[model samples]
Target: MNYQLNINWPDFIKNYWQKRPLLIKQGFTNFIDPISANDLAGLAMEDEVDSRLVSFQNGSWNVTHGPFDSYDQLAKTGWSLLVQAVNHWHYPSTALIAPFRVLSDWRIDDLMVSYSVPAGGVGPHIDQYDVFIIQGLGRRHWRVGEKIALKQHCPHPDLLQVEPFAAIIDKQLEPGDILYIPPGFPHEGYSIETSLNYSVGFRSPTSRELFSSFADYLIANDLGNYHYSDPDIATRDNPAMILPTELTEIQHIMQQLLAQPHIFNHWFGTFISQSRHELDIAPPEPSYTVEQVIQLLCQGNTLYKLNGLRTLNVADQYFVNGEQLISPKLNITAINILCEKQEIHADMLGNALNDKDFMQLVTKLINDGYWYFND
Candidate 1:
């Protein structure tokens, strides 16, 4: 089932987006759940999928990772199962992400679905990423606390949670209800009955992630070859002691690398466009010819982007999945369709077919399972 969301995009962004928690009752009118509890359980058993089963019984919390062979031992109640990146495998869940494109594209993460029995929930926790939890199937009582530094604990290695904070907003969410929580807001949802919830999460890299990835990029590319040398040698009382000036110089070197906006932009463009989760990419067995692709386009068929493949448009450059596609000889208007539209229309192809580079790039992407004809 597809949801026709009723959202005030400008107002939502101006007021509540990333600033605070929001609850939109009946966000989707006459809404129908797209996936079921059985579907979620089935997905949790897949090897490539990220999944977990959480249960709290008799004041003891148990956490288990999957590919679960069986869930027969899990209690009928007090257990919740979560499957990550559902959008990558399930086409219907992907539709739930479209309305949120009003926000930044690179920030968009994957859809995670959860199934819970009555009174079941993962403990109170804080997420660094922003998320919208859409209630489906049945009711869930949700509580969101203040966005502050709360003390966290780990009962199990896999589960990290905060002590229950005072909820600023507490409500029972029914099917079609949407609750938006920004980063660092401690939140928890307990099932009132058997239920399903869809979380659309958005990611922002941490300083540590950026630092480590940038260093790796430098190593892989053999960049930053400049050696540090101080013409003015500092005299120290002890030969073993490092000088303050030298420390400052070392810090400045790293800062310079970070300050190069162009290099950072290129690295980030590739980094953000690739999913942390596995993508459903399997290149075509028999490659489609350029003439065949052109014929399909000429026949007025649209090409849909593969699910979970990220695309970004920065100036004339188009970054798809992880590689960069320099815009065809044509201007930005033609190439903009690559990032802006899910389906690349025939009209948008325009004169790009005349260019070998554009045709080759398109064929390569098609063969790589990044894009496909609507037929």
Candidate 2:
């Protein structure tokens, strides 16, 4: 189920990607919903799924976390149900994200779907990441304000909303329209009737987050082991005061850790390749033998990477689900092919299948639940 997304990539990237908001009519022509409202509600009931219910009544906003037992408490209107990372659990919905692969795969977050009844909304707010909100089953009226600084306040402990903003673009969205909103732009949407909106969110890691992850990496690898030692002893009247030279030396030591490209790249590759949400991974019940896997491929069975599993490469080094693939003793090109594509066939493996080391690695990946065969 490959969806057709009509857009001029070069033009959109140049003019509107992060610069402003753009409403693309018929972005997904004759769009058919991959999941229904009832199915979405079913997902919310699962203990592992991250979901929330937001409702506004009597001029107050309320929010509750889910694994909810019932929706009987929900108000007739002015309420919405949101479930995160639908693509990881629903196979049909994964196709909706395939068309957006024109952008970097590592930057993608997940597919969040929300269902709203008449007059339902989450209120005006700003996000720190870019998102593409596609209208699904019914109509929704949306208002998008320009990217600007605005004061935000939390109505509910879990929800933060912005003050009123002047809309730059306001319109009614039908089944196939898309609303692209960049970071820091204020926007709000409400249902004209019962509707579903699929939001494809992208990640933008902040400096604080990067530094924190790097610090953890440093600790894990026992890096930054250098101890400061000044051979020269200086006598100053104020010995308690920390000298500027000592401060500079401390900063220099920290910078040295970041200057090592090998260390930094390994940490980043492993870090970014990790999925933020849980993946639907099921190892084969009986396990697979190398010979059996080879026979299946020869019989024209295709190998499909698990949905929401991140497989990426940094030069010849490849990573999947936070662990680096052992490649020094294996065929590098074959590893690249596996990392580069979502699916592969026997011919795609070429001579790699003949190499025992490569086959051993592939067998481990399959057994570990990172990759599987399509039945």
Candidate 3:
């Protein structure tokens, strides 16, 4: 996955990312598809895969759980199958997500593949995350509009669609063409033929959502339990009214939670490394003893890399799989390579393995199916 970085990455991100939409023709010259339509359908059939089929008929929306055996039963039009978290399950699709890694991994989400029949689309809807919609096979007509009054919109139970907007850019995208739509943009696509679209979405959590998730994490982890307290406070004269002192105490608790650098980093890192849902991991059929696992690593017969996992290293800590590995002795250079780069050479694991605890940690990861070895 070699990218020329043709567009100035930083400037484009600062100026247009999440602000507007753009189409880059020939985004990847001579690009080969990582997964075929059949392969995608096969994945959808898996019980653990997050898949859905959405269709519209008689001016009403209908959606069903997928693992669809065939598409023949449908109206043949006005329907789409969406499969989320393709990257976690398919190694081939990783290339589709490579370009977006230039931005922070936390900002980038997963690759969602949608297969649409002729004239199929979800509708004119806005997304909360930035997305790159890549046309794979056939062609699709895309129309995008600046965010405007959504009141004119008529809602369907399954889809959040608006009345058609004056398209700022209306174009038919062929294979290899890309449509990049930022958050808040209203866009719709219609397939001229049976089409496959890969939506590479970036993460954009709202403040409210983040706060809620963080609060949940705090409670789950049994951290930051200080309650609002005002020993010298007086009750409000108005029976129904809350006291200003209580508000101040609540604000103080929030400030205190945010002020602790260690706690904040730990929580944030765990939240980031944690998978949105349990990934489909095929653990070793016959588990090995800890000594056997260590021997495999020592023998250089097996290679281990994190599975469906991304890690962040801030300060002296490295975070992965919702846990922090605080290692001042571990080489920052080595750790960075492990986090960002998918493949790591056998020699790189040498120093880390010298420590028995570290080797055990690696073994546990492999045993838990968070890491896999190449034998």
Candidate 4:
């Protein structure tokens, strides 16, 4: 999990990152996978896991639902099994996400693992998010090209394909090698051998998505009460027809919402913390009352820590599970460490639990499996 940034981090962020794609050679050397292929397949069997099997047969693309029985059937030819959010389901695979912490943790998306057969590929496609594809067991030949017009690119129902272009970078990635691709770049990879690829992606929300999410957040928070109105009266024969002034007013309202102070930070933090689907968590068999939980903390019987949860501390506020907890007294250092560090040490829970409301909050988190304590 120790990542050494070869290139100047700040310079790359300011210059190339997202503006273009750059492949880092041996980004992680001697990196050992925490989970094996069998383990990954076991995870795919879970009902909560989102998985798909994509294969190229008879010169066409085919996809199937997974919880696959085995990869042996598809091992010889072109096929791949992809599982999303592997970190949420398996602790071992979660280590794959650790190296990218050099960048902002808030921007780090889920880790997607794909197991492919020899010569397997998903075809040339443009991704919306920045991704680092790390080779695990075998080799993968990757061809990457610069961003081009979608009109020039041909599309398939199952895959977004582009006309073949000369690869700016054509290379075979071996074990521990990494290929980083920024958004809008047309790239493709074919497995040279039976292989597993780990994709660590970064979040990149579109302008429309951002505006819509901000509006949703405003509605949820009961903020931005301004109703749309056009002072200039305009009547049309068709009442259902929308007027241009009304359209202008709506646009103004959107702009006003975007201008609010600390709005982006608030919205982004909440959006990131909120899980798209419920995480797999096993709460304590017998839940304790809030008072009992508080008493346990006071008595030092157990240590309470956030369970498989990532939190964001923004502007003296703590956010998790779309809920915000603000406290000037809460140690920023402790909060940062809690967010970054996988586990909270026994000592760190003392001050946080002293506040009755905070203690109750923590207790609720425990009951909800967002936090847990050991006896």
TM-score versus the correct structure, for each prediction: 0.92, 0.95, 0.88, 0.83
lDDT measured at residue 34 in model 2 versus the true structure, 0 to 100: 95
Candidate 4's displacement at residue 146, Å, is 1.6
Residue pairs in candidate 4 whose N, alpha carbon or C atoms collide under 3 angstroms: none
TM-score: the better of candidates 3 and 4: 3
Better of 1 and 4 by lDDT: 1
Q: Give candidate 3 misplaced runs (Cα > 4 Å).
A: 1-6, 152-155, 234-246, 288-307, 326-331, 348-357
Q: Which ten residues in a row have the lowest lDDT in candidate 1?
A: 326-335
Query: Tens digit of lDDT per residue, candidate 1, span 1-375?
Result: 556888898898899988999999999877788887888899899998999999999899999999998988988789899999999888778888888887878888999999999988998999988899999989999999998888999987889999979999999999999999998899999999999999999988998998888888888878898799999998888999998899999999888887897777777777777788998787776889888888888888888888877888654457887777763453455556666777786778778756667777778889888988755
Flag regions of model 4 displaced more than 4 Å. Answer: 1-8, 69-75, 150-156, 218-225, 228-251, 262-268, 288-308, 326-333, 349-357, 373-375
Question: How close to the true structure is residue 131 of candidate 2, measured as C-alpha lDDT?
Answer: 97
Output the lDDT of residue 30, model 1. Answer: 77
**In model 1, which runs have C-alpha deviations exceeding 4 angstroms?**
238-244, 326-331, 353-355
Best by TM-score: 2
Candidate 2 local accuracy as lDDT? Answer: 0.90
Whole-model lDDT per candidate: 0.85, 0.90, 0.76, 0.74
Question: Where does model 2 exceed 4 Å of error?
Answer: none
Candidate 2 vs candidate 4: the TM-score winner is 2
Cα misplacement distance, residue 17 of candidate 1 (Å) = 2.7
Candidate 4: count the clashes.
Answer: 0
